[model samples]
Target: MILLQANNVMRRFGADVLFHDVNLQIQEHGRTALVGRNGAGKTTLLKMIAGITSPDEGTIAKSKDLTIGYLAQDQGLDSQNTIWAELDLVFAPLHKMEKQIHQLEDQLASLDPSTRKFQLTTEKYSQLQADFKKRGGYEYESRMRGILKGFGFEEDDYQTAINSLSGGQKTKLALAKILLQSPDLLILDEPTNHLDMNVLAWLEDYLKSYQGALLVVSHDRYFLDRVVSDIYDLDNHTLRHYTGNYTQFMEHKQEWLTAEWKHYEQQQKKISKLEDFVNRNIVRASTTKRAQARRKQLEKMERLERPETDDKSIHFRFYSEKDSGNEVLDVEKAVVGYNDQKLAGPLSFTVRKPQRIGIIGPNGIGKSTLLKSILDRIPLVSGTIKLGANLQIGYYDQEQQQLHPEKSVLNEVWDDHPNIAEKDIRSLLGSFLFVGDDVYKLVHDLSGGEKARLELTKLSFKPINFLILDEPTNHLDIDSREVLENAINEFNGTVLFISHDRYFINQVATDVLDMNALGIKHYEGNYDNYLEAVNKEKATNANQDESQTTTTKPKKSSAQQSYQQSKETQRARRKLQRRVDKLEEEMTVLEEKQEAIKEQMSQPEIATDIGKLSDLQKKLDKFTTQSEDVELEWTSAAEELEKFDQENS
Candidate 1:
């Protein structure tokens, strides 16, 4: 069943049409994600669907009793209410039903048992009780607790005043309320804005299992890929539907666009060829009939115009005049926290030149604090932070409060970097997708994403050797995020940034700094490698815990003992096999390099001269790096093999 349908939806801002002739049908249990660039009217379309705004030239038809829960990007709760009270309001109707049932029960007790009124009252009370049970009223409180907890809210936080909560916390609470409501349709804007990985994973699972329809406006590609089954791309004053996750949508959308451009090009070529043929032969005496035919073809040929693509993709390249020293930042015995509650270390780590580190933790777990401590915005309780000589730091804060709201976008860029030419400034702004009148728009009027882009545009103008970005991808759309990610990847300087975006981490992080209950642990790998290490540690811990628990238990039977022995033997064999595999890989690399050297030696002129000998020596030096890497691998593999053999013996 179609839950909501919009026909010929047209929205305009003054003389400019935001979207026109838009038709959309949302069926029951549909999960759709709306995607577009910043200022592409995604939020406006959502507002229209939620009835907070009206379309100038169309109607939205919603099913009767089609309860909708809409969470805007900027959601607010009544400041007077506590978080618990705010969520409890979602179940107000259920509470009312329970009260009415209690009243009926009292009336039944006061009535005569033989009376029809008494019998009817009893029947109604029984029905009410059953309805309450069916609605899970008995388990509602527990369910709410679980939901709130999954959203990174502690039990104590439930009673916290909503007014005291930060903007991000308020957004989370609002989302929790919506989840508790469990309406027929859920509309969320930028839902993953403040979510951590754990909370995000929980949400993805929850949304997957959600019974109702979902329409989300989010820039988190990973989140959309996980939760949304379909994508609605709002582009060029229209809506286009793609039947897949974000990744698949991107692939198919590009393929379709490519095919469309090709078709347009082919038609243009045909028209141009016909016009040329007609022009050349029209006045020729020898081919008047052919000329007439060519002219007819030219006249009949339909012109194909290409659809306009956004010319405002920001081309970001960081300007670093010179490289910093080997060590970019070093922290020794750093103790960082607030209000006497310490989060993580007594930690020490060094970020070398060309190092890209990702700082990850839960919502309030001091990821931002750590960044601030390094930046010297917050005083470390103890320990010293050292910066490399001549290090230039470029920081991108998530809030973007650094930008003066009164200034125009162009002024914001030019005010700080006056050395940049007007033409270059415009080009730089255009690269960040702020072009023409867009650059002229006041900073105060820009959306969060737009402001973020503008700040990035300004940052791109400066020369810096080190970057400290806090949630850099916070307000960016998917495309903008990609552009930033590409820029960061191309950067040669060191970067230490905090981000919850897994895709961005994978793309940019060369090292992982995980802040947890224990101090920050440095892993010499990206997010995937960190996960693997974490999993391995977890498995090892679990095995130790299981072994200790088993040892404390009563002695097992012979049959159980035999099973345990077999399991241990199999584990040892698998470990040995893994080591053998690594050694084999190392041997293969060594053989390949040796073969390459032999081939190089087989060259006739290069074999006998001093110049050739020098060239061969350079090749040998190049081969040494590869050989060293393989040797390291082989050593580790050999150690693992020996350890496994000793354990078995």
Candidate 2:
């Protein structure tokens, strides 16, 4: 069943047509993502669906009882109310029903049981009670609390006034309220903008398990991939649907575009040949009829336009003057914190050159503060920060304050690096998606994301070996983020950055610097490896804690010693089993290779070649013999491991 449908939607702004003859149908429980370029009619279409703004010409239909909850980019809540009070509004209906039921119950206790009016009122009260119970009204408060907590609102902040909260905090609170309402359709615009990695993951899980449909407008590729199963691309004043996640959509779209381009090219070639033939033969008396026919066919043929490309891509290049000595940054007794809270310890650590380090912590922690202190933007209470020799740093600040608001986009790059030519500056800005009129736009008028791109453009144009980036993925769409990630992966410079984008960190980070209550702990691995190490450490700690509680004193009994020995033996057997599993995987590869060779030998053309046939036979025999040996070893190890487990049990 369709939850909402819009037919022949036409919307325009002044003299420009945003979209024309657009038709959209949102089905029940559909998860759709809206995507397009910056000025595309994505947000405009969403507004029409939300009924916040009327389309110039369209008919929108919704189910009789359907309810929609729209979260715009700038979510405005009642500033005077507290966060708890705002969330409580979601359960206002239930609260009213409860009050009415309570009043009826009081009247019934005081009235005669035989009165018809009293009996009717009592029956109505009972029905209301049942309805409330069915809707989990009794646990509504707890459910609201849970939703708020899941959205990263703390218990203390719940009582804080909404007016005191920051813009990002208010957006989170608005999202919590929307979730609690349980609307039939959810329209979210840039929901992941203010979310951290953990909160983003939580929201993803919630959306995946939600019963209603979702129409999200976001630039976060990873978030879209997790929450949306379909994409409605609003481009060129038209809508195109792709039935898959973002990655699959990219693949399918690429394939379709490639095929279309090939057909278009072929047609163009044929048209060119036909035109030449017509030109040469039109003057000949013998082929006049044929020439005329070809000319008519050419006139009727439809021309194909070339696909648009991302031409405004900055040419990113890095230059290293001299490889820094061992240490890139050194901090000693760093007392870093805000007004009343201390996030980490006053400890010391060394950052080495050529190390791609990732700083991770919860939102509102001192991660950003630490970066500022290192750059001398913020003063630490007590610490000495040392930089390596000749360490010219290129910083990508999340706020992008380095950009002058009055300057044009083109001038922002060229003014800083005066040595660069005007043409080269234009080319650089173009690479970053500032083209034609976009280059002339004032910095103050640019969107938050566009400013970020411009900052990166400037950084890329400069020659620097050390980079300090904070949330570099901010304001970048998925494709742009992927391009930035690729550039970073290929860069041969030292990098220390803080980002909540797990996908970005996983792709680029070579070392993990975890900022927790215990201070900055260095782990030598990528994000996945670091997570595994942390999990293993947690398991070990849990085991130690359990053992400490169970055995406060040393056990001197012979049976206890034997049990411990048996446990050790079982662990060793499991380790051997893992090795045997590895060997079996290798053997499977060999068998697959042997099968491929046999299939090739069975081919008629290959069978005609004696030399190739002999080679295949030899390879098959070798693999078969190796497979048998692997099977034997695997079986023996399995049996031994099973015996050890049985003994331990």
RMSD of each: 10.4, 14.8
Q: Taking the candidates one at a time, how many backbone clashes does each contain?
A: 2, 4
Tens digit of lDDT per residue, candidate 1, span 469-575? 99999777788788898788767688999999976786678799887755778986666567667766776666667665444433555643553454446445654
At residue 483, what lDDT does model 2 achieve? 79
Model 2 steric clash pairs: 312-430, 312-431, 313-431, 314-431
Lowest-sum lDDT 10-residue window in model 1:
559-568
Q: Which whole-number lDDT from 0 to 100 does residue 109 have in model 1?
A: 80
lDDT of each: 0.82, 0.81
What lDDT is reached at residue 129 by model 2? 92
lDDT of 2 by residue, 556-604 (tens): 4563355345434534664566566677777788889888988999999
Candidate 1: Cα lDDT at 396: 92
Q: After superposing candidate 2, which stretches have Cα over 4 Å from the reference?
A: 8-10, 57-59, 114-118, 283-285, 299-305, 309-315, 338-341, 347-349, 406-411, 419-423, 435-442, 523-649
